[model samples]
Target chain A: MIISYFIYFKLQESDFAVTIFFMITVTEIEKLATLARIKLTDAEKQGLTKEIDSILTYIDQIKKATLDIDHTPIVGIVHNIFREDESRVLPPEDREALLKQAPEREGDFVAVKKIIAQD
Target chain B: MIDLKNLTIKKAHEDIKSGKYSAVDLTKAYLEEIKKKNPEINAYLEVFKDAEEQAQAADTRFKAGAATLLTGIPFAIKDNILIKGRRAGSASKILENYHATYDATVIEKLKREGAVFIGRTNMDEFAMGGSTENSAYGVTKNPYDTERVAGGSSGGSAAALAMDGALAALGSDTGGSIRQPASFCGLVGLKATYGAVSRNGVMAMGSSLDQIGPFAKTVTDAEIIFNTIKGNDSLDSTTISDTTYKTKKTDKKLTIGIPKAFLKGDGINKDVLKNFEESIENFKKLGYEIKDVELPNIAYSLPVYYVIMPAEVSSNLSRFDGVRFGLHKDGKDGIDDYFETRGAGFGKEVRRRVLLGTYILSSGYYDAYYNRANALRRVITSDFETAFKTVDIILTPTTPAPAFKIGEKISDPVAMYLEDIFTVTANLTGMPAISIPSGVSGKLPLGIQMTALHGNEALLFKAGKEFLKE
Candidate 1:
């Protein structure tokens, strides 16, 4: 059973001319949790459905902004700082120290569950 | 006993140089204070065991006559900024036992100055919330009033300084993290120009918005810390050199701009408004001109920040999947492992933001939300650009109100987010802003923020020194 919620945002351009609605549902929340790689219980999903709906509704005010003039995203002040291509080998002690942090480690490698399924 | 309450970095430097107190004696005093007050204030997560040794090293430098200003200065570092071999979990359970492999660039620079690091301070888990209530360890209580909170995600840093646990502290401001806490603790905080400080080795939040800054008792102390940690670094490609932005020249007296229309909006406390007016009057008496400037699209800053910040957070936090360095949980398969690990590791706010960011950056809503927010971001930057033509700096109350109770705004995420309304524009436009201690209201401290043109932190320091009469 999926519960759907709708948020109404009045566009800045002729408020009467446009009222756009975005719907967020428990199903959508589940899908988002999956994509975000976090497991949530049914109760958590339901709570997020309501909470995210309100937050999105509040932030949806950006839609009403008139960005007709040069809306290109500002990339910030500094750009295109290219450094010389260089590679340096880590010290053996440093390599051992880094490898020691992994939870499950093989000889010189971090071990993980197999992704490929076999017959 | 060292006069920790009135001790500034300059005074400490001179005292240590003049043999009034040795570096070890200073370190012992702070450690004693941390032991006495930390249990109640909950400011320090873990006081370093080698702090005395670090101070001894500083003393060695002093004996060699190679000491810098920061030598022997005890500092409290936010957990997000790494120190090699130290446990830097960012106050989250996910990385509870995780140790840093290398020093952060800022930490490296401070180490070169022979500074003594006291401990890792507490913060919001992954810096996802405005209050430190989101910390997995515990909440850092306000030093001024124990019933209330020390403003966060840099709460512990502010509380450390407010309680005289450390002479100065380092904090990362995604939006208002540093400034809000500084205001709450009656201290000065700075968020330098976005690229002015290198972000290398610091945990990534909103990549573009996060800048490591200092928390100090006075504006001059804050300026000294800023000078040491700021500069271009090859490790961080986004870093800017001294000449990255042309320095804007001003006439004899610098002009200050007040966004009157924006401040007139609702939700601002009456006391804050009164304090702001008094600040204006004080500046007027200081012989500087104040003008009302319009930021037409400035109201959109909060909404835009929500969109852009979460998007960047979703991307940046993806690295913490429990495989390489942090906590790990076992599951049926590789995919389930990620789900199980992240589900147990992340707190409520971290989960919510990651999910929201995933939703916003998802296929269907990308153009409607993320792109539109970016478009408005450009407009907001331009709004500030236009206003800077006449004003040397812009003034606003750091937070709409003083620090609230620990659980006051914890339940309501949006209400907590409103704490950054006045502080996010600096991040969006990549400007340098300083939050100086204004007069107190009731028992809580209030602060006024001054934002200068890009790469013009000198102007902010000058105005802050004048305003605080430092």
Candidate 2:
């Protein structure tokens, strides 16, 4: 089922003004789930479609915000901290301990399903 | 008996030093309380087996006359913070049975001070929800009213302290997680200025917004924990030193600002508002100047935070791809393997956020949503900067109301998100904020949050101590 979600954006100009409607649907949700690399059940997809639509509508209020100043997001007080490049090796036991937490491991390496296929 | 209910870290330290009781005795008292109250509260996921041993070491330190303020104190650590060789899942099935390979920087620092690790507390899965109901293990019930929820994603830490299961606890706040639960449990919680505390070894969620903080019975205890855990670390370059931001000179009496326009909005509980007014009056009586300040762009904080946090979460959580550690499920192909594993590993709320983040950062929506939100974030931050010019700190109710019932707002994500309205502004502005118990609403506890300018935690500490009369 396709659910039409409309996000209204009002744009103002000296000579003209207009409202733009953006539609989000189940197809977009499926694409998002794929992009996020999470498999969603059919029910979750349906529920999330409605939930995401509502959240989008709520957040759409930002579109009407007028940006009169230019500023980057303030991450923290300190910025551009440069550290010297150094190579440090973990002790063998510490490396082993870290590798031990892996679901599947072989020797010192984490094991995964074969990626490249051959004829 | 240790009189655990009336215990503070300073008093406990003095008692341990005066030989009133050994550190082992204190650890055992907390362990016994955990055994008794944990079943009902579900505060702790696993009580550390070596708690007594750790406390015994503290006793050794006392004998050597090397005891610090936190020495011999038993602490409940939030599951998201790593303690070497202990299970440190962020209360999610994805990381179930995972053990930490190294101690978090805060844990390492606490160990140096001879603090005892009682256990790891429960939290919302990946610190995602506003209530502990999202925990994979079980919901942590409020110690005051078991029928109600312990506010989350740091719910277990708050519940643990409220129940006297530990002397103090650690919790990470991303959009009110620490303060909300602290308010609900009648505790003092501090989310220090961003980068004041290192994030190394703590699980990432909203990298820009996440901050590891303390849940303590008193404002003084919270300050003690914050001082110990905060510093510049080589591992987390985002950490700050004492000299990071130039100190702001303040007058003899601190001036408190109330954003009247913002507080005039809808949905605030009447009792909470009444309690907030009472707190303002108390501040006045204490000789602190109270002023009305304007934060014109503050109303857009929540919307902007919802945009920026999820975008960061999507980028930060991509590391848990089922290849290296934690829970993994196999599928027909390599790509299918990740899909299957994450699908089975993550819970509903985690999945919802990942998808929402993807959509927000996706092409076409990136400029309109993410970039626009970042621009608005700066404006909102500047609003606080402007307000602080006239006021030393800003005050607001920690949450809109007291703790809600377990299943109350779980079904409605927006309602749950609304609980962080007053708390998120601090995170967005990268300022230090503390939530202290103001009064009680009905049977539940209420809190008043005080936010100070970036790198001005001393002002917050002073004002909090004054307000709590600590």
Candidate 3:
């Protein structure tokens, strides 16, 4: 709805601390909100702009650390998992129980707003 | 009337078996304390109505001569962990009325042992923030001081234990969620080695960093609970067995390493450093060698964690699209419906991470931000591996300071994230770490944290027990 109408813009270098006006534009935040699938009020966007700037600035320190070592092995515990090609469906009772929690349910199915609508 | 304050799982089991107190009686004692303190502390979001029924079942098991150590024990569970037929909302409104249809792997294990669950405790919404102030229900106040925060995203579980509301509680650590709270509340908290415990039913935060561990009054209790829940599960393929990261049992005293970089920083409180030094001296008195170890990449842990965690958070949280379950907000179109549901459902902190993660993983920025962070993650993790060769354990203060006033860091996201600086290294490296109460700094509790090589939790428990004695 509101998120889809917001246009995504390219992040220009001027987006950072170049000028007070260039700090974080509403267009940039709208793009991020659309990508994250969350609608932000104008007030929320203004607040987020400031918060995200500081968080990004803090995390920017990682770029300074040199990645001098080649082939940095992925952390120790990562392993490939292989399972048998078998199909196991949830029991009927459990299926019903889970379906009961859906916000919009119609008979045996969970309903949702139509996705094919054109603007 | 059973005494809830001094109760331990071991003592509770003995008293139950000796006819000193029944399981129902023990459960009732904790329930009474929960009723008394939960109103003010807000530790438990909802105390289960079936608590008495669970205790009754445990009592029946004890009567039939089928009691295990955890058979009659009562526990408070962090709301993020699923328990069949119960609400596990992760302190967010999206799942406010959602009921779990099946038990989490750990819940199934505990159920098989007949452990009585007292209630679901509060946490930061989606386990995103460092303070329980992010909880949709409300902030969980520190039991020691109501004006201050109980460190989070597992703050409720820590507060529950601190107030004797539950015997022990289960908490998930993505990055210092469990340990920092335990440190704040003055309890023993453990973050098991990555994949040492299955995360099949826990709310996904950062998949690479998530782990389930326990909060207890004593190190022995934490170990017992850890051993009961830890094992490779078919449901969670990432889990590993004790044999995977085995360490040789040495007769020589264990060597404790201190990364000098984290010890004397500008933000670190002087009292915290004092407690850490006293803990080091305690280890030396116990005949362990204290050595200064250099972990060059350890300093970059926070930035690496910030980048990597949000990337995973954005990906893992995509499942809440309002079509399947949880909250659903009607809109003119499908896309609008998603925006409305998520925007209204998630708390402010959850939305912050989701958006931050999206930006990091989006096109044109992935290589510059996310990839570089991943490379740094590898450097940080391998550095710990190298350090472990020279030292059996690494020690530090659990947090830079004790519990802060409730509104202190809420406005500053970076300031709140700094709480995890000491604890995130263990999660990054897949190593087990424990936070044991050192003493009090002023009215607030202080904790000394120790991290060991992957699957070397036995060393933590042994050292924690020896250190706690002093």
Candidate 4:
């Protein structure tokens, strides 16, 4: 499997004609997980590193796709749809219903983790 | 007892109108079947308690002479779609208790027509995976062979219809979510054009690729359900009026396009290819011409889709933060709260896509991955445009192979994504496609897919009806 990866990596390098050396290490996976705001366990991080490496190797073929069209217009639902910027008040019952979905609520306000603190 | 298996929407409507049976009776028959089969199949996450009440209302409409064709029909809804006062969990523990405060535009339209919803069907959590195995609830088993998957993110919708648990069901297609499962379960599934159906109430996966559609036992039944639920809704600005795409009935001589380069690939299963050829022969018997066509950029569709879809998924699913609704995990800090809540809430496949999407859209690699894929997406769209000028519809196998065992491809995400190879092109191009049961290999059924130009569903339905005649 390691040999296969090396050959595939070399082929991708030549196929896409890009000059960057690449390997999806565990540290990189941890960075991406952080960027995505999802915490992964140590074991999950290792497993995902191997899986993402294989996935990236497979999808690397897209870099090799030859495109003759510089910019073909996207073909569906391109019309500009505008709506009026307006505020509407919800009924009391509806307001209660919406507020009820919050994990924590104080009166009519949804409670959240605080970011600002007095020094 | 009503012969629910052989019942179509038209026959059911006629029977109700003629007083042969009431809507209450029909709903009871389906609810009874759900009770019997749902435990084993796990097709439905929750069967609605108000089904019979709604059917009674439909009976009132029929008596008042205000009945539409769907007035007394029972349909299954995928869990992602919001029906007010009902739970719409999307088969994830995060939203297992979330209830919609308002009905989706489609649900409102169906309600006006007096349709009965039996239950919310199970799905892949947040509509992430191909097989229903990724569902936080449980896997939906194929009715034909219980050991295998029902094929999803719309597996429950298709499985319920396949087992005659519901007369029809609604499903959303982001990639092959609808058609592939329909193919696997021997049902008809349609992925309508991008903006053809309003997405006001359906859960968003990939915004540009997702469209809600129907799954049923027959082509005509699928068409009827589609027509009832489709139309422009002012709430969803992306919707278009019926006249947006000028549709006309076709004559007997209809031309079908076959992308030889795509089908010529050795990766496709032989049984699937054989079944496709037999379908071609069947079309010839119907006096239609089958011609070879080229879609040069077609081979890149799956790769392009992986890039664009994950990017969109990451953006759309960002709304699931612990603040407003759904699961919340308290932590040491605000950022930790965000991390652990989402970490535990989302399924394994959902997390992978989100992270992959983040990687692609991040600064350094953005142009190399996401931007490149978007430009290639244009190439794919135009290929369909050029091909449609020559043929009314394009044909391919719905899946590369039939449904594999439950845990067959789960470990390797790439292998599971490959199952969508033949079906994602339509989504990438924003075109309408349908999958119909063509034939069977061994004990498993195979499906043949037909795609048409934007707003050309009339042609797809026309051809689909003729193809299924045998």
Docking outcome class, model 1: acceptable
Q: Give the Å shift of residue B143 in candidate 4.
A: 0.3
lDDT of 3 at B165: 92
Model 3 / residue B271 / CA error / Å: 0.8
Better of 2 and 4 by DockQ: 4
- Summed over model 1, clashes come to 0
Model 1: residues with Cα > 4 Å off, grouped in runs: A1-23, A69-71, A84-86
Q: In each prediction, how many residue pairs overlap at the backbone (N, C-alpha, C within less than 3 A)?
A: 0, 0, 1, 0
Instruction: Report how far off residue B49 is in candidate 2 (Å).
Output: 0.9
Write model 1 residue lDDT over B1-470, tens digit each, in one string. Answer: 89999999999999999999999999999999999999999999999999999999999999999999999999999999999988899888888679999999999999999999999998999877777899998999998999999999999999999999999999999998899999999999999998899999899999989999999999899999999999999888788878988787643698999998777644788889899999999999999899999998887898899999999999988988889988998889999989999999999999999999999999988998888988888888888999999899999999888889989988878788878889998988889999999989899999999999888998998889989898
Off by over 4 Å in 4: A1-22, A68-77, B246-249
lDDT of 4 by residue, B1-470 (tens): 89987898989999999999999999999999888999999999989898999999999999999999999789999999999888888998778568888898888888888899999999999888888999999999998889999899999998898888889899999999999999999989999988888999888999889999999888999998889888888877778777887664576588999998677645678899899998998998998889999887787788889998999999988888888888899988778888989999998999899888888889987877887888999888889889988888899999988888999889989888888888999999988999999989887889999999888898899999988881
Per-model TM-score versus the true fold: 0.96, 0.96, 0.95, 0.95
Q: Which predicted model would earn the best lDDT?
A: 1
What's the C-alpha lDDT at position B213 in model 1? Answer: 97
- TM-score: model 3 vs. ground truth: 0.95
Candidate 3 Cα outliers beyond 4 Å, as residue runs: A1-22, A69-73
Q: Which residue pairs collide in model 4, if any?
A: none
Q: Lowest summed-lDDT stretch of 10 residues in model 4 chain B?
A: B260-269
Better of 1 and 3 by TM-score: 1
* Standalone chain B TM-score for every prediction: 0.99, 0.99, 0.99, 0.98
| lDDT (C-alpha, whole model) for all candidates | 0.89, 0.88, 0.88, 0.87
* Model 2 misplacement above 4 A: A1-23, A69-71
